[model samples]
Target: MMGGSAYENVGKKWDLGVEEQEWFHGLLPRVEAERLLIEDGDFLIDDDNSILEMVNQYCLSGRPWLDNSDIVLKNPIFREKWLLQNDDIILDRKLGKGYFGDVNKGIYKPMGNAVAVKTCKETFTQEQTKTLLTEGRILKQYAHPNIVRLIGIAAQRQPVLIVMEFVEGGDLLNHLKKQQKPFTSQQLIKMCDDIASGMAYLESKNCVHKELAARNCLVGNGLVVKVSDFGLSRDKVVHTMSDKNKPIPWKWSAPEVLLNGK
Candidate 1:
C-alpha cells in the first residue's frame, strides 16, 4: 500500500518513464484506477494536475464503481466499519419477498433497535454478492429523511444481510391498498411531494432511481414516504441501460428510456 510519505511528494514533477508510470498506476486503489481506465484508456500520469483532473471528472460524472473485485478482496475500510457479525442480528419474522431475496423484521443487538434485514438468496453468485455490497455503499453515502437509511451489512454470514431502518408503516402501495378510505387530495399531494423531494436529492448527487413507484416507496410514522429499493438504481450523470436482455418496467419508464434504451 502507498504510504503517507509517498503522497507527500505528489506536487513534485519527476521524469516518470513508461515502466515507472505503469508501476505507480498499479500502486493506486484497483477499483478507482481501473474504472477511470475503462472510461478513458489513458492513465494521464504525465503530471499531478492531469491525474487530479481525471479524478475530478470521474466524480462529477457520478458513475459508481460497483464492480471492484480488488476492493472487495482487500476488504476496504468502509466494509470493515459496516460489516456486522452474524450473531449481532436476530431475525423475527418475514416482512416481504423480492426476486433476489426476502426481507425480515429483525433486532440489531449492538443498537438494541428494530431493523429490516434483507438477505441474499442461498443460490447467489459472485455478481449478486458484489451488487449487494454496492447497494450498502450507496445507502451509506445518502442521509436524507425521504431516503431509507442503511444500518450496516452482515458480510461474513451465510446469506449476506442488509440492515436498514424499519419503517413501521411498510410499503406505500400496500398501505394504500389496505386502507378502507382513499387518501385526501392534500394527503396524496404530501406523499407525492415527499417522493419528488427524495428524487431531487438523488438527482443532485448524480444518482438515478430507475425504478420509482409506490411499490418501491416506504411509509414511516405520520405517513411520511421514503424512497426504497435501489437494486436497479445507478449513480451516473448519464446512464444508458446496455443490458437489452433484462426486463424494463415499461409502465413506470419514460418514452426516451424505452425508445433510446437509456
Candidate 2:
C-alpha cells in the first residue's frame, strides 16, 4: 500500500526506482517482513518491491510464484530434497538416447528403488544443460499418479543426472507402434482418460505443457499412462514466445501454436 508522492519521496530517499515504489511496502522493515515469512511459501514484498520467498531465500520478480502446494504442501524446495547425492545412484544399463544424452536404468540405493537416469553429455551446448535443469525444476514441483515423478537431480559434478521414477513399459508411441493387436475401445478410452487427468492436474497448477505428444507420455503397468517430458513446459498460464525460429512439432502442435508461435 505504499504509493503516492509522499511514499515516492521516501522511495527516492531509499534509492528505490519508480517501478519498485509501486509494489514496495515502504513502511514494512526487512526484519518485520522476515519475521512474517516464517512458514513455507510465506513471502512479502520488500522496500525494493522484490518478492522475498523466505523459505527458499530468493528475491524474485515478474510472474514468480510458490511451487504447486495443492499436490504436496510444505515440501522442501528444489535445492533441498530434490538435489540427489551422486553416490547414492548406481546406473545399470542404457534405456535410450535422449536429446541431451543417454537415458539409463538405475537404482537409487537410499530407497532401493529403480529409477530412470538422464545425463547431460559432456559435449552438450549451454542451452541443452539449461533445458535439463529447467525440466528438473518443473518436475520437482508436481505430484500426480498420472504424471511421472522426479526423484531428484545429481548436479554436484560433471555429467549431471536427472533421476525419475522408472516405468517399465516405455514411451506410448513405441508401445502403440509395436502392438500386434489393435487396442479395444475401452483400453483406448482409458489411455485418453489418463492423459487428460495428468493434463488437468497441470492446468490446476497453472502450468502449460508446450509440447505434449505420444512420445512424451509413458505407459506403466496395467496400461497406465503418465505425462513425462517437460523440457518445454512453462508455469504460467500464458506463455510469450520470443523466438519464432525455434522449431516445434508441427504435426503434433495445436493450430493456434503453429499459427501464432505461442
Highest lDDT against the true fold, candidate: 2
TM-score of each: 0.68, 0.66
Clashing pairs in 2: none
Full-model lDDT for every candidate = 0.68, 0.69
**lDDT accuracy of residue 165 in candidate 2:** 95
- Model 1 lDDT, full chain set: 0.68
Give one digit per residue, the lDDT tens place, for model 2 in 1-262: 2123222232222243322223333323344356554564433343333432331222222123446432212211122466666667899999998777889999999899899999889887656665677678678889999999999887655577899999999999999999999999999999999999999999898777777899999999999999998766766644456677888887766555667666
After superposition, candidate 2 runs with Cα above 4 Å error: 1-79, 125-127, 237-242, 254-256
Mind giving the per-residue lDDT tens digits that candidate 1 earns over 1-262? 3233222333422354322232132112245345544322233232223454334334334333256522211111112345566568999999989766999999999999999999889799867766676777677788899999888877553577889999999999899999999899999999999999998998788777777878999999888999998887765654457689999997876455667676
